[model samples]
Target: MQLLLVFQGRKLRITVILGAHNVRDREQSQQRIHVRQWVIHPKYSCEGFKNDIVLLKVGINTSPPAHLPKPLNLFLVPSGAECEVAGWGRTSLTGNGSNVMREVELKVQKEKICQQLFKNYQPQSMICVGDDYRKKGVYKGDSGGPLICNQKAHGIASHVPYGYVYPEVFTRISYFKPWIREQLRKFSLQDLPGSPFSD
Candidate 1:
């Protein structure tokens, strides 16, 4: 098993690990596929956290792919739906990240809650999640993680306002389903020789 280290910025490096339980563990079953390329959404806005999804092209591998939850369920996710968010991020305000992957259960908040919290809240593109009273949520290092509801990935952890005390915002996957499909189709056709989509 190999670990592919990809640099996001001059100071930020990311290691995409597959089939691994512990971040520090070098288990024989774990495999790290090298990322060949990545594409960010053209309409992404940093200020408002709109269209904040990225597609990555990785090298082909023999490891069986993990079962991904189907996108676009054709039904709306009701408010207060219990969901889970997992990450290797810090557990506390001043604590360091854990070595093992961890997850926390949070409920989806109503659109009005986010509207009251954020000036730029866009319900069409974002999902608000967390337990405000309990002060439980995705912390500093949990950004870009998935908000899994009923086994489907509904959101991507986007930002937390003023800290984790308030609800965290996520990029709604369902809202951008068309964009995701278009990107995947483009990437799939890129490998053909002399194709216009070729990298």
Candidate 2:
């Protein structure tokens, strides 16, 4: 799969490279899509790892082959909720990444537990999920994927330590719903002011 980024009415391709191990044939499995636009949270910070979420405006050139979860509108995911996470990330802690996307079920951990585990964890902006007992969770290469619960996007996979023992961190969608709506509104206004596709 590929991520599309449209800037100033020009389409830019962002390749999504997956490992070859999980695929039957790597060359034939590659895919691409055209994205109309994308907006990252204004308060996002790479240094402190805060507010790690982005909203993508996909174009109508092609529709997703499979059903996609819609964004959760002002919905708060409760602790212990079983959520599904899918990605082409590493299968094991010591293994190379996977070529085919894999999906796994994880339970959302309490905010207090996450804060205790991660010193820099921001409770208001983040959520944690994993199977600590089995050491199973999101690892390297899984960043920016969605955390789906109840057929809605509740979080975005954000961070995890080197080892897979700790719970994976995710950007809480509920906390930033207003910001996301605002950005989408701004984009709509800019594009609809006259010729919708005008540069």
Candidate 3:
């Protein structure tokens, strides 16, 4: 059977990747769009170490979400790392910039802190951020987007409650790394079950 790759004859129309609904809503979030290609993508997270992988793939919020839990576990780019958070949701309730996108600076916060502030809502491996002053933050349309830092993805935007000054909830990434590798290996035949790391 042939899979339908897109609707309206275009992936661009259906995909959330780099699209308008993903622009963030911060005062300085404007120019940050230039970093689209600058962040690391698995192959390298930093110099010399060469394993500073950081990227994200946003998807639609499916209904009856399978076995997924309410907290909505996500990826953890890493704690205390510097990264950018992007979304296409509104800067205010009115809506984000109509013409431009949005991005904001984020400092990965301690998982414990997140849990405490969120009434123990955070889970293992979760890295939270953006509970700062009442500037714009992620909203309903922004789910499944990236919470990047140090040019790597730390988490995905999982949930944001109403009246949130800024989005504080997120999903961790590192725990999923092994699962991602296993699938890649099976698909590409890149390595045996116990192969060493490679370039």
lDDT of each: 0.77, 0.72, 0.49
Q: If both were scored by TM-score, which would come out higher, candidate 1 or candidate 3?
A: 1
lDDT for each residue of candidate 1 in 83-156, tens digit (9 for 90 to 100): 99999888888899878888889988888889988899998788888866766788878888888888778888
TM-score of each: 0.84, 0.75, 0.51
lDDT of 2 by residue, 38-90 (tens): 77777777754798887766544243432233345333677889999888788
Task: After superposing candidate 1 on the true structure, give the runs of residues whose Cα lies further than 4 Å from its correct spot.
Answer: 1-15, 61-75, 194-199
**lDDT-superior candidate, 2 or 3:** 2
Question: How many clashes show up per model?
Answer: 0, 0, 21
State the lDDT of candidate 3 residue by residue for 73-177, as single tens digits.
Answer: 343344656667766555666555333546777665566666665654535544566656536566656566677665555566766545664546665666456
Displacement of residue 6 (Cα, Å) in model 2 is 12
Per lDDT, the best of the predicted structures is: 1
Pick out the ten consecutive residues of candidate 2 with the lowest summed lDDT. Answer: 61-70
